[model samples]
Target: MNTLSKKNDLIDEFDIIAKFFTPLAKDAPGTFGLLEDAAILPTIDSHQEWVVTVESIVCNVHFLPNDPFELIARKALRVTLSDLAAMGAKPYGYTLTIALNRDLSDSCYLLEKVSHGLTIDQAEFGIHLIGGDSVSTDGPITLAITAFGITNKAKALRRSAAMPGQDLWISGTIGDGALGLQVAKGILSKQYSDLAGRYRLPQPRISLGCRLSEIAAAAIDVSDGLILDASHIANQSKCRLVIDGGALPISESVSRIIADHSEMFELILTGGDDYELLFTAEPEAIQKIKQAGYELDIPITRIGRVDSGEGVDVLDHNGIKLNLLIEPGWTHF
Candidate 1:
């Protein structure tokens, strides 16, 4: 086993992966998981390949320590599933790794609840657990999951395919997860329980993503905030992304927060963890995209456009750039 060692001190997650795990996959062709969002494994059949992604959630960092074990477990699984959803892959199965603190008397109960949560989502998404590992830890409880799916398309969607003149679109409403966190922390009113629920369980757009490979030029999940994630497409595709702030789709829960405090709009843009799909497609495919969304019963909205330039620009309805208070999205570093 490889460990991250910086003169015996641990470095950051990205650094650790790049220095340790990346080298392990050097000879493994198609195992670009370190360089890209997911790893692709070629199969015997030419038409399909395995798309695999893994993510870890910590007790206090990703979710509140005291949050329901059930919700935490669902989030742990769903976040990895969201990665598969971004690549237009169909769920197959997953492996879970849990580091538990044995000192807690309710550890068994918590494990039961987490397993129950996983069972519910597995049935809902039509996926199953293949294998996993568990161990005791004196530190905070941590959960890691490796999820894999299969895509029948000749090629899974990539973040580097967007081109100038394409339209930027998003599935489902935004800002719910960010606002939901505030609601969970009691920073905002609890009258908006939907917002809190959104924070707890994100609806991964798996069905819509499966259909989008043929329509979308590029796609990514908005786990790091809309502006930040859109910037990823911009940087990857070498095109400028201009998002219309006015065109942003907001749910009733988000609308309520904005109605009371307009400043919350910043949260809507930069707040991360929505896990919704943010994608780009040519204008000619707009009708087909909408048709697909309708068939999937998911609302798709066009809120921006790709243009010839650099970076991402967000403009108000008046077409004036709004000065941002902070960086566009969440950064682990």
Candidate 2:
């Protein structure tokens, strides 16, 4: 693949596409390696097997401008891929649209670096670049990716499927992404680089999600903050969720930091962008779910349970619900 341009600046639209993007579409059927007007998805068992989702991210909003090039590119794709994971889907391919900021002085370098990152992640995630568009923009560097995945026909998971009395669980630890952002802004020491890594290169829980279709009644990836996402499950399912504040799965580093900076606990609850999976399943499936988590090596923690109410309740050691978030009608009153 022609990964770079000899010139220091982007030459033209076609030049950019030929050098950077076409190789990404390589070997995916019907894509013509992005050398066509449109593309067709690889044929599946049925239309019901297809799961499609799209998400757009802007520099300095979803990600910082100075973050590594590959990270930014991977972040854009992983964000969209997580949507499919939430639905218990394996990746098919994706089309990306990149709007390059005119203000960038090193546009060619940026494109080269971003494309290199995309190339690496495409291979890692087993996805092909089907097709996409690139254009100039007066605003910040922005990317919109439309991702496709495949799942068992009619068996995709949904946020609105949780029922009262089901157990609530999450994959991986939380707060790392939020803490990572703080590290980026220099609010924390470099000892917390792991947290920052979580922010930059989020590992989508595809294995956990794929296993969940048979185990979970409802599922959603934790992109927005944990409490916010859990509220989505409750609101959509028209049930209440009660979580124990002390039971949230946290890493050793996070536990140490929280012990010293008690007030920083809020970041764990409200700091969004952790791409872990939050799901609900029947109480009887606890052992089965734990087995799946063990087999997958992704720790699964049961933080709460679905209840017959309208919102979310996070109970403290005193058994009283805490008003941690000000989201009216969503948090327990």
State residue 283's C-alpha deviation in candidate 1, in Å. 0.5
In TM-score terms, candidate 1 sits at: 0.86
Predicted candidate 2 versus true structure: per-residue lDDT over 200-315, tens digit per residue: 99999887888998889999998878888988999999999898888999987789889999887877887878899999999999999999988999899999899998878888
**TM-scores of the models, in the order given:** 0.86, 0.94
| Model 1 accuracy (lDDT, Cα) | 0.83
lDDT value, residue 305 of candidate 2:
91
Question: For this target, which candidate reaches the highest TM-score against the unseen true structure?
Answer: 2
Among all candidates shown, the one with the greatest lDDT: 2
Model 2: how far residue 305 lies from native, Å:
0.3
- C-alpha displacement of 268 in model 1, angstroms? 0.8
